[model samples]
Target: MSRAIEVILRDEIFTELEIEYPDDRNTNLLEQGMDSAGFLKLVVLMESKFNIAVPDEDLLFENFSTAGLIIHYLTEKTMS
Candidate 1:
């Protein structure tokens, strides 16, 4: 799921920024280059691709900080 999310982020969200996917899954994307707009794009893409609605409460930075966190959040949501 993380791999797929990486592909979507690279191909769709980060394409305009020309930002490469980091080698470290734990890397903070915002620190690297991602802006608020890019972060929102990622959230929207995740919703569309995963068919999951991210609640307002889950909009915290921690949940969207890294690839692994995003995958884990979605996995937890689906499991619930």
Candidate 2:
């Protein structure tokens, strides 16, 4: 699932956002040209693709700051 999420994020979300997927999954997306619009797009894509609604409280930078973190968050959300 983590690999799948990484692929979608790299091939779909990042492409739509016009941002390049970093070589390092732990790279900070905000530093990689991900702006507010990109972040919103990411959230929307994750919700639709994962079939999970992200609560407002989970909208923290730590949860979405990097690809690895996003995958981890989605993994936990889907499991619960």
Candidate 3:
């Protein structure tokens, strides 16, 4: 799932943003050039791709701050 998320993120968000960065899970997405709009789009895309709804309370920076975090968040949400 993490690899799939990474590929989608690279193709959809990072590539669109023209960002160049390693595929490090701990890499900070915001630091890598993802902006507010990109983040929103990512959230929407994740919800759609994973078939999971991210609750309002879970919409925190800590949850989506990095690629790994987003994958982790989705794993938890979907598994629950």
Highest lDDT among the candidates is held by which one?
2
lDDT digits (tens) for residues 32-71 of candidate 2: 9988777888899889877999999987777899888888
**TM-scores for all candidates?**
0.73, 0.88, 0.73
Candidate 2: where is the Cα deviation over 4 Å? none
Model 3 Cα shift for residue 36 (angstroms)? 1.0
lDDT of 3 by residue, 1-80 (tens): 66676676667655655666456889897778777887777778778767888788887777788878877776677677
Residues 1-80 of candidate 1 have per-residue lDDT tens digits of 55665576557655655566667879887876877877777778777766789889888777778766766777776567
- Lowest lDDT 10-mer window, candidate 1? 9-18
Find the 10 residues in a row with the least total lDDT in model 3: 13-22
How high a TM-score does candidate 3 get? Answer: 0.73
lDDT of the candidates, in the order given: 0.72, 0.85, 0.73
Order of all candidates by lDDT, from best down to worst?
A: 2, 3, 1
**Model 1 lDDT on a 0 to 1 scale:** 0.72
The best candidate by TM-score is 2
Clashing pairs in 3: none
Score candidate 2 by TM-score against the native.
0.88
Candidate 1 residues lying further than 4 Å off, grouped into runs, are 1-18
Give the Å shift of residue 28 in candidate 1.
Answer: 0.7
